[model samples]
Target chain A: MKDKQNLTGNLGALVKNFSNLHSIEPDSMLDLNTTTFLQKLVSKDVIDAGVRVKPKDYLKSLVLLEYFSGIIEGDYMACKNLAKISEKIRKIEDEEDTSVDPHERDSYLTLPVVIAEAALCANEKEDTYSDNASLKKIKVRYQNHDMKIDLHSPKSKKPEPYYDMIGQMVLDVTSKSVEHYLEKVSSRAELSSLIFTGHALDMIKSDSQKSKVKTALEKKDYFSASLEALKGIMKDITISVIDEYISNLEG
Target chain B: MGKKVVQGGELLFKEDIIIDEEAVRMQLTIPSRIPIFSIDEMQVFYNSHVFTLTKNSSKDAMIKVYTTEYGLNEEKSPKLQEDEYFKANTAEVNKLKEEFIKKAVIGMPDNCYDKSLEKQACLTLVEKINHAYDIAEHSYKAPPSKGLVPKLSDDSIFNTYIGDFERAMLLDGKVYRLETIQEYLSMFQKAIEPKFYKELEKKSVLMTPEEAFKELTDNRHKIHPWGFPFIRNKIWYNEKSFKIFLDGIYWIPKFASTSKNAEEKYRNAIERKIKTDAAEEGFGK
Candidate 1:
């Protein structure tokens, strides 16, 4: 019920991570909500060295980061769908031929989770998804939530029509789980990461940023690439959902 | 001077193709309405396909397609969102796969069956030289759930045959630096490897020694198999519309590549392969 409070637990971990990166104490950047968080990002000089999100429109980046990083929670499906619906709105704005199939959306939804799991684990350099803790956490989260999911032994699945009732359960679980997990993580250091989704590609400002993202993608450092792509979505497409949702949640 | 029987090269222009009642009833009939996938849908489709070597529906899987309207000499393709073209470059690679399967690809052997219960002579010991070993290997995976994921066949070799229906989406050949067809071939050899390999393997089987030599009569004809079906948007020199014969390869132009190449090849290859397969008189009787 205390949605923002629940999210802020994980948000606290975000602050500690930021503080550590800035070589400052944890007291700094007290409230990790969008607007004030932006201020902290600047004060810490975390702007250029770490997760170089655009200081200007980084709120969009934050929304994506928080939403996607939460994939480690049992409640991620709802968050992903909500983000996607928001993205669908953005697609319509850009006049894209969009078919956001509920079935196919899982792959799109799982991407950030996979990226987060890969990049945030302590032993990232050596771990594949099969062995990654983040992946295990998510699969466990889903199972604990009563969703039948088996990573090691997967069976073929059929596509079916979307149903609203199933959609509601997905949403309900996601909101509660995220709220619970966000508040539970003790510090910013405990936060898995949204680092990869925390950037924006404002090419109007520079081409080097684009090249940096491109080079990262070509090198298959998908964490870096995801951040860049999220930034691209925010910059080239629409950021209204991120901005509006966070603003409303913060209020 | 114009040449003899065209060797299924030179993407059959919209003007050159015509469909009638007979062509419609042929073995590889041009589909009345092919689903024009969005970027995301296409990405999933391309990545899931074993033929494309994209095993896991990984979003990063590379596919090739035609950028343009690389369909047969039809008046229209399924309508796209105005911005679908620009965004199409970033997603999964194939557009032709579904139609390829629908048109004329080989059947994958089904795997789901009850395990033969070897009557254990005793409950403990396993069977040594049993009839179970004689059972031909089959794909053990159960039939895929519908709507969960669109199914792709496991026939990898048959998948290679998809290439023989070679069509590239070259942006109407404007992006190329090719001075010769061979140059174009060399530059885009990777795109056509599937088709080339399929042809190399099948042609020997599909023809008699005498018939094979006779078939080279059209070797002088230039063919660029890449299809760009949507590119017909530019004011067409617009020839008479043609229908795919379904018994031979029909070239559609750069429908798009990587992403475009995958889709274009999927469409053109499926269409032509059906016609080619159906028309194989040698394989017939």
Candidate 2:
């Protein structure tokens, strides 16, 4: 009877602390809301306990089944805190105009966000890998298209770097003839034009323009003929025209 | 050996005199310009004594020399021997042999006889022939007449093929290239231009403003959802109603102008209405 009373008092204190932290007004909420609030309160307590614990020590403690089980109710809080961190990072990113130096900007922020989002969104959507094994394998559908890519990595892996590598690998594999893939992707959307990365655009343009130059060379007019065909490959234009020109050259 | 006298007017002859090797060598040294004879008819000659070098046997007529022992008795004289000097003249023979071999090398066939070269030439020739035949056949089939065929120039036929404006252009001495006009007719014979123009005129005369509004609504499906509001509002305006509501306005103006005794007043009014409506719709003012 004494122990039960002590547990009730601790729970009341946790609820009070959570309400204070989240700025939620005290009210009679539903069971799920109450559970969520308790989870956030417990997660804060764990963080408070780990204030002096090094990140490595904290991560080691998280690896233990006993420690992780004790924190099961606080997983939502950890996820929310991570989301808040990501939001803050995003706000900082938006303050600076990075359009002019998109590549450098993307390297700085997009890669990290892409990595975090891959894991976070996957977890949120119930698409996370089931195994806690070293190599965690998952598949994500890109752009709601038929293209599904498999990602595999160790559980101890940082999400950002892993996703960045995966993204680059996909780009490399598709780069050989990205125009063909882009055409298919755009057609599925019933679009006449598509905007892609500058590199992809340049590649397609050069490929098409080179052929046009070759044709001009065949016609014996090399002077006005341009080899610099793909200057603005990344810009939007009627894809059918490019496709027709390519087909005409091939014929 | 004693020299014997011949009868008057009879000539003394030597065995090798009739066939001189030197004369043969001279003739052989001259290169033949005729490709056919040099390639096909040249003969090879061999020297029996000098196995290393072959020469024309008919040339080199120097008589054989002999070494004699003067001490020998007349009765036992080494049975009149032929000369050993004929034993192959190695240096001269080698030189002649080299020259003959060089000439033979020069006489060898050229590389033009390869299969690919022959095939390419055959293809080119065939293409040229086919092109020439096509041109000739087309010319023969459609020879240009001295004057226009009366049947071809009939207004009814013109109206049946080309729309009113095109017909007028044809009759008004403005159109060029009869071949182009004829080709178009032949290509699209089923698409009678007069019938199309008449339908357009009927639509213009008969369609009501309400009906045009209904049509614009019906055609909304053909337009993008984002573009629908702009087009709908443009045609809905009262002042521009006639111009915006008319069906086939794009074709009617050209055909109406071609009508005989068409009044400029109606055209001007129509054009003004069209311009006003176009301006409202954000087109040309």
Which numbered prediction scores highest in lDDT against the true structure? Answer: 1
Docking quality category of candidate 2 according to DockQ thresholds = incorrect
Tens digit of per-residue lDDT, candidate 2, span A56-86: 1222122221112122122334333434543
Misplaced by over 4 Å in model 1 are: A1-251, B1-261, B282-284
Per-residue lDDT over A1-251 for candidate 1, one digit per residue giving the tens place of the 0 to 100 score: 35542343234323322322232322221111221233323223222222322222233333334434333332333334344544553443422222431112222223223223223331222232335675666444323323222212323121111111111112222223122232332222222222332233322134665676667645644344444444444344333434553355346
- Per-residue lDDT of candidate 2, residues B1-285 (tens digit): 222223244432222112122322222321212111111111111110101111222122110001100110111111111111112333443344344323322211222233343333334333432333221211112212222211122222112222222211111111211122123123322333455434433553444334433443554444344443333332232321211100111100011122222222222222222222221222111
Return the interface RMSD of the candidates, in order shown, one decimal each.
23.8, 49.0
Off by over 4 Å in 2: A1-87, A90-108, A127-179, A183-186, A189-251, B1-285
Per-residue lDDT of B1-285 in model 1, one digit per residue for the tens?
221222233322222222232332233334422333221111111212311112122232222111111122211112232123313522222223233222322221112121111111111111211121122223323221223324343333223422322222111111111111122123333433455534533563444223322332222121222221111111111121211111122212222223444344444443443333332211111
The root-mean-square deviation over C-alpha atoms between each candidate and the true structure, in angstroms, is: 28.2, 42.8
lDDT of 2 at B106: 28
- Which whole-number lDDT from 0 to 100 does residue A203 have in model 2? 38
What lDDT score is found at residue A182 in candidate 1? 29
Q: Report candidate 2's fraction of native contacts.
A: 0.00
